[model samples]
Target: MLEISPAIKNLEKEDIADNLLHYVYNTKHLLSLIKKGIDLDDPSYLSSYRSFEGEVYENFIYEKLLRYAEENDYITKFVLKGFHQGKCKAYANTLSISEKEQIVYRTKSREISEFDAMFLTKNNELYFVEMTLVKSVLKLRRRLRKKKALLEIIFPNYTIKSLIILNEGATGAKQFPSYCKVWFTKEFSAAEVLEYITKLDKQKLLPKDKINSKKMIEAHMLKLHPFRYYNTMSWITKTIRANKKYVIDMNFLMTEKVQRYHDLYNKFYVGFLTVKEMKNILHLKEGEYSEEQRVVVALEKKHSDEIVVTYYIQTTRKNLYLYSFNDAKVVKEKKDPYGITVTEVFHINKLMNESYLLSISQVNTIKKLLKERFKRESQKPNEK
Candidate 1:
C-alpha cells in the first residue's frame, strides 16, 4: 500500500466543525465533484469514498499533465468523456473501461478500473501512467511492474510506454530499478511530465513484449485494483477549489494586475495588460478599479458582451495561466513559484482580448461565493 506524509494525511481529516473535510484539497477531485454534483457541506456525502492521501497526489499530477498537454498540443486533442478528435484524445482522472479500451476479467468477475492518467498521441501511441506517493522503494518498484504488465495486456496493438511518477522530497539520490524514469516532485513541476512524454513519443519507445491472455490480464487488474479515478475526483475538487491557493502549490500559477481579465478572456496562451489599456475594452474611466473587489469588462463573443468581476480566495492556487498560441509552435512565459515576483512574459498579443489588471478588493466575497456555489451545485443533479 502507498503511504502519505502526515501533512498530507491531515488534509483528509475532520475540520474545526468536525465535518468530514476531504477531497477539498485535491484538484482532480474538485473538477470531478463539480461535474458530478457531490456535495461537500454534508458529512454523509463524505462516507461514500475512501480518504487516501496518495489519491490527492495522483489527482494533482493527473490534471497538470492534461493541462500541459493541451497548452502544448502534445496529444492534439482531449476529452473528459469519450474520444472526440480522432486518435489523439487524453483523459484525465478517468477510467479505461470505456468501449475504446477496456478489459473484462472473467476469473475475477470484473473490469479494469481507470488509470491515474492515460494519453494517446496523434501517432496512436500510448502513455499509460500510474502515480505513487510513498516512502517504500520495494513497494513502489513492485507496483510499477504490475501496472506495466496490465497496460500492455490491454493495449496489445499499440506501442506502450508505462511510466511511474514517484513524488519524493528528500535532497538525496532517488533510484529507480531501470523500469522507468523516476521524477522528484520536489525538484520538478508536475507539468514537466508532458515534456517527457513528448520526448518518448518522438522516439517511439515500445513496451516489453507481452503475451498475457485477455482473461488473465483482466483478472490481475480487477484483483489488484491497479488504478482509480472517480470518488477521489469528487472529494479532491472540493478541497482544491475550496481553498485553491492553499491546496495548490505556487509552481503552476502566477498572479498579476490583470489575472481576472486574463482568466475571463483567455484567448491566447499568454498576454499582457495594464489598467489603462483595458479602459478601451471595458469602457470604464480611470480609477474605476480603485475599490479593488469588483470590476467589469466587455467580451468579443461569449456569454455576454460585458462581464462582472467577482473576488475570491484560493489556497490551492491564485494565479492565471496566460499563454500566446502560435498555432502548433507555441511559446509560454513561466516563473519559478518560490518568489514574490511574477514571471516574465516571452510572448503576448495585445489585440486579442487585451487584458487589464483590476484593483484588488479588500474583501472575501469572492471566496464565499465560491464555497456556496460548489456546495449548491454538488447538491444538484447533473441534468440538461
Candidate 2:
C-alpha cells in the first residue's frame, strides 16, 4: 500500500500508520500553491513542509529539474543523432509502484532500483537523481552511493552524474564526492539554473577528467566507498544546535501548522450548519461505523479545545448553527483557518442560507448519536 504517513522510508515501514490519513490531504494544498506559481518560500509553505516524506521535496525539485531540462539541451527529441545534438534526455521516473520495474547489473546481478528522477545527455551520459527531505544525511549518503553504483552499471554506455538534492542543512561536509554531488536547495535556484542551462548550451563544456584533477577525484573515490565517511550530517546538526535559527523556527512551524489544520477543519465547518450536515462532518466515507468514527473525532477535537465548535439554533436562518469560534485564534479575525475571510459579508449571506433542514427530533437524534460516537471513540463500553 502507498505510505500515508510521512515518517516511513519509501513506504516500507508502517511504524507511523496511526498518523496516516492527513498526508494525502496536505499534499493537495501544496500542489494547489505550486500550480499558481506561488514562490515556495513563505512560512506557510516552509513550516508545513517537514511533515511530509521526500515526495514533497521530490515534486518541488521536479519542477526545477523539469524547467532546467527543457530550457537546456536535455529534452531534445530523438533525432537521427538522438536529438539536442545527442546531448541529453532527462525526465521523471514514470513507473508503477506495485511492480518490480528496474534495470539489473549483469556483473553484480544487483538491481538499479526505482529512481526519483532521471537525466540522459546525448554524450550518452546519464544523470540519476535522488531527492530527499530526510534529516539523516548519513542514511541518505548510504542509500545514494548504492544507487550510484547500480545506476552506473545499468547505463554502462553513459557517464553518470550521481546527484542527490538535499534540503538545506542536510549535509555538513565542505568536501564531498566529485562524482556523487549533493546540492543543497537553498544554495541553488531553479530559475537561475533554467536561465543558465539555456546559455550553457552555447558555452563550450570541459570533459569530466578536468573536473576531477585534484581532491575531486578523491571525493569521487569516497562516494564509491561511502562507508569510509564518518564526518556527515552529525557535524552540521551540532552546529545547528548552537545557532537555533539554523533549524526551522518552532514558532512559525507550530502557528502555521495548526492554522493549516484549522483551515481543513473549517472547510467543512463554515459552509454547512445543521444537525445533518454537522453530524456527518467527520464522515470521510459512507457507512454508519465511519459516520460514528467521524463523530468521535469531531467531539475529540472539541473536547480537547483544539477547536471551539458548538451548535446553536439560528432563528432567522431557520436551522442549527454548527459554529466554530475560529476567528478568535487568528490575528484581526482575518481568516478562519480556512483562508476564508472571517467577516466577509458576501459569503455571510450564502453561508447563512445554506443550512441544514432539520426537525427538532432529528436534531436530538444526531446529538445523541454524537454522545454515542464519543463513547465509542473512547473505546469504553455503554457509557454514552
Candidate 3:
C-alpha cells in the first residue's frame, strides 16, 4: 500500500495542461505547435507528458517523506557525507537523504560501487534507502545485497540498516533479509517509520571480524557477478560521458591506486596547452592544423610525427568528445540519442592504434580491455 500526497493526487487536467504549455513555450516549441495547429497529440505534448509521467512516482515518495518528516519531527537535516569527503549540508525539506554516493575500489581495475539514497541519523546510524516500483523481489534482493556489501567496505563502523520501499501490492516482502525493513507503499504509517529508526539505534553493528578486506570483497563481488571488469568500465564510461563536465570530483578518491586516474583527468582539464603554444610545438599555422569544435591541437607525440590530444567541447545541446591524431578525421554517421558516434579516424600506427597516444597507464587499460573483450568472445561459442 503506497500513499501519494493529497496535493499530488488532486492535480487537475487544466493544471497539467498549463505546465505542458509552459514547457513548450520555454523550449521554443510553442510557436511551432501554434503554426502546426493546437494538436494535443503532438510529440512536444507527448514529450512533456512522458517526462511528467516519470516524475509522478518520484514526487509522490518525496512528498510523502517530507510530510511524514515534518509531521513526526524524525530528522534534524538532510546531509551528504562521503567516506573521505566532508559533510555537505542542505536545509531539511525531505528525509535525511543523501543520493547517488559512490565507492571507489583500490584494485588494478579501479571498479566503483554507487548506492542510491542514504538516510543518516544524528546518532550516526544509517539507512540505505531504496525506493522502487520494481515488482520482482529476486531482483530487489540481489541489488540490495551487493549494495550492502559495498557499504560495509566503506562504512564498517556505522550501524548500516536497509529500508526498501516498494510499490503497493508488490509481493515477496517476507523473502528479504530479517534485518531489512520492507515497506510497501500505502501500507506503512509514519509511526512505523519512526519506530524503524528507533530500533536501529539498539541493533548491534556488523561484526568487524565478519567483514572482508578490500581485496577479499572485490574477489567476492566478482565471483557473485562475473564480467565485472566490463560492467565496471561501462558504468564509468557512461557516467563520465553523461556528466560531460570532464572534471573528475576530487572527493571520489578512497585509495592511492586511483590517484593516477585523477592525474590523467587533470592532464586534460588543467594541463591543456594553448592553441598558440600548440602551433609552436607542431610548427603548424591556422590553416595547417585541423580544427573541429575547437582548434584541435597536438598535446603529445605518439609516433615520429603523429600527435594526439584529448579534449571536450561544449556544444549548444551538450558537450562532445573530440580527439586529435596526426591523420585523424571526423566521420559522421547515424547519431545516437546523444548525437555522438564512433567517428574518429586515425592512422593505424601500432602505438596510436593500440593506445590512442595515451600514457603507459592508459595503454595498460587497453590491455585489460583486450583481455576482457576476447574472453567474452571466446565464451560466446560455448553458450551455443
Cα lDDT computed for each candidate against the true fold: 0.34, 0.36, 0.37
- Please give the lDDT score at residue 149 for candidate 3: 50
Q: In lDDT terms, which candidate is top?
A: 3
Clashing pairs in 3: 1-185, 1-186, 1-187, 2-185, 2-186, 3-186
TM-score of each: 0.29, 0.30, 0.32
lDDT of 2 at 306: 35
Between candidates 1 and 3, the one scoring higher on lDDT is 3
The residue-by-residue lDDT of candidate 1 on 44-89, one tens digit each, is 4343222334544565554444444554443632323121112322
Compose the digit string of candidate 3's lDDT tens values, residues 171-192: 7888887648776554322222
Runs off by more than 4 Å, candidate 3: 1-55, 70-77, 80-116, 186-384
* Model 3 TM-score (2 dp): 0.32
Q: What residue runs in model 1 are displaced by over 4 Å at the alpha carbon?
A: 1-51, 76-108, 111-114, 122-124, 170-179, 187-384
lDDT of 2 at 316: 31
| Per-model RMSD to reference | 22.9, 22.3, 17.6
Best first by lDDT, ranked: 3, 2, 1
Quote the positional error of residue 57 for candidate 2 in Å.
Answer: 1.4
Candidate 2: pairs in clash: 79-83, 86-122, 87-121, 87-122, 88-121, 88-122, 89-120, 263-337
